[model samples]
Target: MTEMEWEGEFDPMSDPEEQRHLLSVLDSFRSYRRLAHFNGTHVRRQAFYSLPQEHWTLLSKPPFSVLDSFSKLDDLIDCNAELAEAIFKAGFRAFLAPTLDSDWVASVVPKKYADDDFRTYSIIMDNMKVQTSQNDMEKARSCINQFYREWSAEGAVERSKCFEPVLVALQHEFDMRKEADPGLDRSAVHVLAPGAGLGRLVFDICRAGFSVEGNEISYHELMASSLILNHTENVGQFKIAPFALSCSNHLSRTDQFQEFQIPDVHPSSELADAIGSKVPAHERMSMATGDFCVLYSQHEHKHEFDAVATVFFIDTAPNVIRYIETVRNCLKPDGIWINLGPLLWHHISRKEDDEREDKSRGRRDVVDAGISDPGSVELTNNEVIALVEHLGFVIITQKFNAFESGYMSNPRSMLQSSYRPAFWIARRKPSSS
Candidate 1:
């Protein structure tokens, strides 16, 4: 185990290598701190379930308190080998098994790329350190801002089961509408996938025979997704090395280098062949980069889409009501909106009185003048659902589920993170005739 030490400050103008090292080291220390917090928080939550066959060997045959005979020389010098082994096995079962499970999710790096793995691993591993200094919030901000986009893109899954609800609901709606009017044009069905990262979901929707446009706000993701969608030949086969920590639950050591394939939109030729359509996938699909709330206000896009789909995106906005209103404007009457994501809001908040003042007067002025404002406070899931209904959206289908979802999550940690995602399908109410 690496000795715990204090974090040191670094010059902002340092070389890229040094800067990378500084950030990685600080992140390692942060991870250690987060793990410590997790342990402390979960100490009392015991799992009463039966252990699997592998862990059966760890239980003691009989229990006896060694401290009862502490005065005896043998008792003081005794080595309880079985107890030590049991503890080690339990730690391994929780923290180490997940890394192996990760390998099953995606292919591992080949032997030829072993050098590449070690090269990347060395860079991250060499910087691990015990942080003893006072917390630095600015450093945390810098690290997250620099790497979060890349991490998100690399972690996208090939076919996320989380998307099943949206797909199934959409297909049912499409079939129902078609049956009602047999002459309806299938090719004219359009979908708007906002906050789409790397265009995987959009691509899949297009494959299902809908004209899809993906909208993203982050330039980092836009650039990376574009590279995968338009430029790469075998786009879905793209891969990257993500983690650098070793399997021993120690930041000081390095895990064996492994690469995982990142999910991307299918190549244009393949999609065209599968869809049997004259329009290619590139033509059937497009990406627009901008704040989604303002995207349609300038273009001839109002009430244009047949449906809107958002996965892991509604929570990105500070005020989700704005998103709901935007969806109302972007969809035709009775147009569907399918959303799947946790309601955990990511934006920071301000005093309610100040928010009202800005809304009553200066908010529009600030936006028109391109002056940025602090994001709106997050709303609970129930609040957002009620807001959608108040905005004239009739809820069609609503389902709730809890599961783990994310890219590049550390496989060594058994602290598998999960969220309660709300799968909602709603439609815009037609105007009163």
Candidate 2:
């Protein structure tokens, strides 16, 4: 069987649904200005307008006038608009660039070219359109905050707490393997990072001299990561006020308006520097965009990876057992599987139709097939380990409350939330003949 590279870019003609989804995501970015204007500006201003006339007089004069505050918000909204434009353009370029092929060109060519079997095409961004929804706008806003967690220097502390242990474990395993096999090549140490949202961990693994691939299923994540991983050229190249939209949990207005520079490290330059000439940085790291189970369970992928690293990912399954089975099937004999994150169980409350939508997006669940109901088998940490053993894995390392980390948290917000997640490393047992 031929190995499928799985670049994750869907062909527009063949996969119209995915194309529509991509366009909708792009439209969300494009609608940022309108949404921000209505939600941020208009709503807040209306509250101010409702105040008594005497109170208005007090807010109008003084060290900081109400108009002055509104001016600052307007400016912040403009900055967000600029960032949204960049995101939309980057996503457009990344997703559509691959479609400039002979077949695609022939479809849009002139009559003469069509008759002669010649091909010509021009990609017009204006011609492609999609309407944005309230849901899309909300996700777009969330995606902006994700940049803080994934790329900003201010988020390094949280990322270090969550990612450092996984990195150390992988490196230690690599060192032990090198000691056992003196001729082992770092390039041959293949690692797979499933549900690699925004790809910070994947970049770290590749920098540690291991060939890595990141897999993600969210269009929001995939589009944003494409811009950062592929198009970014410099450190701190973009600035964003991630907390600008939040109206609560602020000790000071300065905290609310705080701006952060994104991509603390330039992905391409840093990866190139670390990997050197042994393998091109691009070849050392890649991203596969699809469901983890479906993509990795294929014949060509069986026994294909030396290690699989999952961070804040596994709990997304409706049937976590299927996830365990897929991990076992994809790993070579005695291959390692490292996991970190709490048992949040994303699909616990999802309706049947929601489960079907997930399956359509490549996520498989027993609930959709009538084999189980939502949250039917939510397991405790020990039960999860027991299930891992039952599915042909031997626990190598396990820990509870491994680390405290925040996801997309605002440092200045008065309310702070965190997760004290479980961490483990398991080895797939050799198959019995």
Best candidate (score: lDDT): 2
Model 2 clashes, total count? 0
* Residue 234 lDDT in candidate 1: 56
| Top of the candidates by TM-score | 2
lDDT of 2 by residue, 1-433 (tens): 1111327633533566556666777778877877898888788888887899888778878764866777787788777776676777776656765665655554555556443311121223334535765666777888887888888898898888788888888888878998999887677788999998888898888888888998987777777787777777689888888888887888877888998898899887787688423766667787897767766766778998999999998888777887887788788888899999999887776666545544444323322332233344688888899999988999999888756788888866899998999999998899810
Question: Candidate 1: misplaced stretches above 4 Å?
Answer: 1-159, 183-185, 235-238, 245-256, 262-266, 276-279, 349-375, 402-404, 410-412
Query: What's each prediction's TM-score?
Result: 0.57, 0.86
Would you list the C-alpha lDDT of every candidate in the order shown?
Answer: 0.51, 0.75
lDDT of 1 by residue, 1-433 (tens): 1111111122212344323333333333334324322332222122211445334333312242212212121221111111112222222222223333444322443445455533223232333332322232222222222222232343433135566667787788778888988866545678999887656677667777767888864333443455445444554343333332222342321232234443333456546565534455555676675567766443467888999999888887766767887888889899999988887665444345324423332224225311023456668778888999999899988877645565335544444455667888888999711
TM-score of 1: 0.57
Clashes of 1: 1
Mark the regions of model 2 whose C-alpha exceeds 4 Å error after superposition: 1-6, 9-13, 97-129, 275-277, 349-376
